[model samples]
Target: MDHSIGEIALRAGVTVKAVRYYSDLGLLDSWRAPPGHRRYDEDAVGRLELIRRLRALGIDLPTVRAVLTGERTLSDVATARAEALAVQIRTLQLRQAVLRVVAQRPEEIHQMSDFTEFDDDRQALVTDFLDAVIGDDPELRGIRQTLTPELPDDAADHQVCAWLELAQMLPDAAFRATVRQMVADWRSDWRADDLRPGVVAALRQRVGPALAAAIDPASPEARAMVDEITADYARQLGKPADHELRTRLSSLLETAGDPRWFRYLRLLAAVNGWQDPEPLQPIYDWTRTALRHAG
Candidate 1:
């Protein structure tokens, strides 16, 4: 038995207009009955239902037709659609990350817009920006590597945000100049043991406990911490850990250390999945304060 257009629409749980639209597109076949009225077979109901499912998945009319006509298999269409949706999902996620950055730093919104996607050119620009600011110093090569955000094609939400923040920081004139000066000052100093890994490791091992204990920088405990750290540095530099050396080290710490500069490294750690080295900052601060009044 044949069903009228109204019956087909009712059976498919669709509107009369939708049934008519699909019929016009040749997706639903209809025949003229005795009274010249449109009549649809049971197969037409199944066709209409399939069309509805494909449209719900955002498949275009042509692709839907291809599936209907056997030009493409259902699996082929579904696979292609899934890949397209993945691309759209990534685009939306990146947009969300960009907006989050924009909201947090409205004044820097201009810098956030250029990163809708991180392509090779953008990656190269980021590297060049770092190289220009960091200079060609062999001593800082490790630092350059640590600070760069190597964004993968499938970066996570936090990684994307890190990349955006890193990008914005790269072009900042004041941040660049401060970092450059700090590197230069570190290289010029004879007792800048912080730049040496073994000395820093020693400082952290000795000073870390005192900092955590909240020992007063002026107290004997904190003074002992400073003395131990300075002795190690003095041995490396072949100088005595005297009051003058301690004063000069305190002055250098005052000039070069900035918590804001450390934020870049924190962002890098987030992007690269590194163990967070945040505890070192407080230890350094505690040592700096102790050294200031060591004399």
Candidate 2:
């Protein structure tokens, strides 16, 4: 049977005013009563119910009208609305994290300004380091220029947190100097050529068994392993495997093997939506400890 507007409202669990609004919006069809007052059919009652449910989900009236009029399908509208809500939720969560950080570390409140004005300072620091190292060599410069970590315009809470921690760590004068010196050493032709090949060969020929057995870096086996690896590296670099070279190599390994650099790479991988490398710090440290003992 046909229903009056009030009856439709009661059945749809919406106010009479809301039903009238829907009718005005052309979302609910109505027919003339005996005296031309609006009357609705069972279909209109069902349509009103659908509109109420969608409105409860924060769907705007225009979109609800579009869905009701078949200008947009329900599935498409629902998917769009879900995606919009997800973005809103993420934005709110980021704001909460920012506020929490500000409240807990009032001294670092200056950092909050940077979040709004610039990309994370850690990203800038990394960029500066790459530029300094590769600036002179056109071929290397091209590669370094291409190495950008595309952090999101609106990053998630954890990513922002990681960025902040990284920024704080890299700005210390000692840390910056250490990084610069390491980069300079690596840029030298001899050290640059020797790095990957020499390290890999040394590990394979000398430390393979200890690495396989997962020997602790401080263990006696690790010491012998380091000595063998150092000897191999010396031959490869054409340096005498003496006290000075051993000391230099040990220091180089420690600086280059900083956990922050690994962490930076991991975060950069995330920012750029790339696959992260397997962690290398443990192996590097094992190699370092072995070298120290050998020296």
lDDT per residue (tens digit) for residues 1-295 in model 1: 7999999999988999999899888888998888787899999999999999899999999999999999999999999999988878866777777676667778867766786564555678677777777766787888777777766555666776777778777778888877766666667757366546786677678877776687899998777768887787777878888887777666556544566577877877877777665545676677788887676
The digit string of per-residue lDDT tens for model 2 on 58-117 reads 999889888987899999999999998876775566566677767767787787656433
RMSD of each: 6.9, 7.8
Which is the leading candidate under TM-score?
1
Query: Which stretches of model 2 miss by more than 4 angstroms?
Result: 34-36, 113-162, 167-230, 237-295
Candidate 1 segments whose C-alpha is farther than 4 A from its true place: 1-111, 118-121, 138-140, 189-191
Best by lDDT: 1
Per-model TM against the reference: 0.59, 0.56
**How displaced is residue 225 in candidate 2, in Å?**
12
Question: Candidate 2 local accuracy as lDDT?
Answer: 0.71
Q: Indicate the TM-score of model 2.
A: 0.56
